[model samples]
Target: MSLDAPYIARAAKPGQFVQIRCNDSFEPLLRRPFSIHRVKGEGSRVKDIEILYEVVGKGTEILAGKKEGDFIDVLGPLGNGFILPRTTNHERRTTNSEPRAIIIAGGIGAAPLVYLAEELTKKKIKTIILIGAKTKNLILCEKDFKKATPEVYISTDDGTYGSQGFVSKLFHKILKTTESKFETIVYVCGPHGMLKCIVDICQERKFECHASLEEKMACGIGVCLGCAVKTKSGIKLACKDGPVFNASELIW
Candidate 1:
């Protein structure tokens, strides 16, 4: 869903999200949180912000029915965003010392990372993306990610397309086989099980990992504490503190 919100588009960063109200009525009561997929326009004149969502239930079903010109109640650019890699002096002059970054997306979680991949590519960082879904039809944003980097690997649980297995396993294989000596960072968004698996691998391999978590929220702000997550530093609100957190800070 593309929204004509220039203010949000200008301020939005990769890994931040928005909460949208499906209807004006109290049927759903709370809003639904969706990752800011991509921002449209260039320079300081952004025109619109886009969000990707699936019609899982009533709220999204109603959201799917919205017309293009329809006004939507959106509360946005929420939570902390991913920390992008800074361009080093050496990287500007040569490709030998360039940093490498990897993105792992599971199912609909592929939405937010497209923006991150684009930003990394613009900085000339070697960016790779691993996308996983249950089947080929469920895979999201393959074409969009390929625009940023050519190293897009895909896997499905049922072996319908690409590799036949979990994406986390594919990541492990890449980490093991790759000969690049530059620093590497991994960013991931996916099912809880997949996140945990990737985090474990990162921990064992000593690679820095960042994860975008998906959680239910009653309030998009810090109040209510409905979407609290346990981290190394105690409880943190997913809506306010983060939807993106360092893998080391997370408990599970």
Candidate 2:
């Protein structure tokens, strides 16, 4: 849902996230983590920032009760964000045949990709999003993503939505059939099993890939050392060092 956090909207970037306090009381004391789903407005005068989530726990249940005028405590836009291509000169970028992106998300992982897509589209870089979910109702963000780019593909565990299978199958099909025409990089976030499969495909084909990981974060800053992941460079905190890391860097 959208929040009128102008400060967060102004400072947020793709792949970065926020930590929210669900209630004023101390019962569910620690805050919960969320990705910045969308950021709006212009320059430093940002108007809104959005977050996508599910109510599977106590914190979320409390959050669902928030009213229109209610004030919620949020700490963000936190963590290192996606490292978007920095080249400002599109002519040069296109001339160099800079790689296009393929964004893969499963279930709620789609949240961050929408924001990432907005950044890529503004840069005029092509992006194709692949989304997969257990059912149609669980699928998220297709409409918003389509507005950023016309290329979107979806799959479902049941045949209730787009294709009746896993999203990785769609990726495999593209690799087996039409991938030679473009230079590609993959950006993915999903269940651990799902991500491993996707990363394996990219690794075998030698495609550069990045992944956004979610961890139980405490003290959203680094001091807590709660969100560590084993990376090729060594152990790093998902909160301070990343929620995003190169696929190659992860131990998997």
Candidate 3:
């Protein structure tokens, strides 16, 4: 079954995300959050939107098994994503040169990173991608990311492919080896534990970072209020206020 859902895409940003309900049944009571993936066209009418998700549990498995014609319910263009610093945003206002962007993905986290990379590339912004998985087979969208960024790095825990170490390790190594004194921004999407670790690293290194979070969701539009997360500011809904937030804003 072909899946199609029409949505307004006016608010989508590179790191923003959405929530989806794969089935009407309540067996899986919560909605699933997926990165905006990609938003096409402009204005009130969005030509297309894409989301890449891995089948992990009941909800996602149901989504994965869906045929081409199936229609899944989605509530979206939600959350605050990575906003380039005004200075940097202004510098790249007219030209794309000198905006250095780096993306890191773990497993299915590659989904949003791919979309983010694509957008950056369209703006003529230079990007680098670092993707990690336990093995090569688990690495998602290798070709897509490579196409978006001139430099792409791969790391596997088992040494089955690419660099044989943690993705974070490879990221640090790259930072060390590169001589380019450019302002760099980071966007990451992945498991909570992995994100926490990355956040720690970013804090220690003083790197500007943005992260897309995942949690149990229900309504996806904030009505359920099930995806609340504790932030430095206060309690906020992950499904509405975020699935994406600045690393500094998080209490982690």
Candidate 4:
């Protein structure tokens, strides 16, 4: 859904999200958090922001039924965002070769990465995206990602899509076969099991990695401490301290 929130659109960074009030009734007291799917506008003029969501619960079901031109309450551009690689931090194999970025998304997790991939393309970085779904119809953002980068891979667990296998398994094979000469970074957003597996692979490969954590938030702000994650440093709030965190920083 596209929302006419100009300031939120302008300020939103890749991996950042927004808290939306699903309905006016107090039945569902808390607002739901959604990643900023994409920003819509032209040069320096951000008209609106988009949100990609699944109707997994009553809140999202209510949101899904809202018509266009309706005013929805939204609290914006929240949480820490992804850090882009510049020349100083990222390694380059050769003077002419650019740094490579590998993005792994499972199901609706692909939502946030579309914005990131577009930004990466604008920086002229080589970006490859791997999207996983249960079936061919469950895949998200293939066309949007293709517009951003040509190198997009798809995997479905049911053998109904591009590749027939778990996406994590495919990712491991790719990492194992990749040459050490190329500098690569990975970004992932998915199920806990998938995230943990990918984190292990990245750790073993010694690749810089970041992950967008999907957690339930009671209070979108940090107050309730509802969305706490155990990190290497200490306990951190997912709603405020992250949603996006460096993979190394997480205990998992």
Give Cα distance to truth, residue 220, candidate 2, Å: 0.7
Q: Of the pair 1 and 4, which is ahead by TM-score?
A: 1
| Model 4 agreement with the true structure over 2-113: per-residue lDDT tens digits | 9999999989999999999999899688899999999998668887999999999999999999999999999989999887765544344455544688999999998899
User: What's the distance in Å from true for residue 214, model 4?
Assistant: 0.9
**Model 3's TM-score against the true structure:** 0.86
Task: List ranges where model 3 is wrong by over 4 Å.
Answer: 1-3, 9-11, 40-46, 85-97
Q: What's the TM-score of every candidate structure?
A: 0.95, 0.94, 0.86, 0.94
Task: Give the 10-residue window scoring lowest on summed lDDT in candidate 1.
Answer: 89-98
Model 2 lDDT per residue over 25-130, tens place: 9979999999999998777778799889889899999988888878999999898988775444453334445667899999988989899999999988878888
For model 1, the stretches where C-alpha displacement exceeds 4 angstroms are 89-97
**Whole-model lDDT, candidate 3?**
0.76
Off by over 4 Å in 4: 88-97, 176-179
Please, what are the lDDT tens digits per residue for candidate 3 over residues 218-246? 67777877888888999888877877778
Provide the RMSD of all predictions against the true structure, rounded to 1 decimal: 2.4, 2.1, 3.3, 2.1
Which lDDT tens digits does candidate 1 get at residues 1-252?
A: 889999889999999999998999998989999989999999888879998988999899999999979999999889998987657755343445556798999999898999899888888889989999999999999999999999999999999999999998788788778876766789999999999999899888777799999999988898989999999999999998899999999987
Q: Which of 3 and 4 is the better model by TM-score?
A: 4
TM-score of 2: 0.94
Which candidate do you rate higher for lDDT, 1 or 2?
1
Ten residues in sequence with the least summed lDDT for candidate 3: 1-10
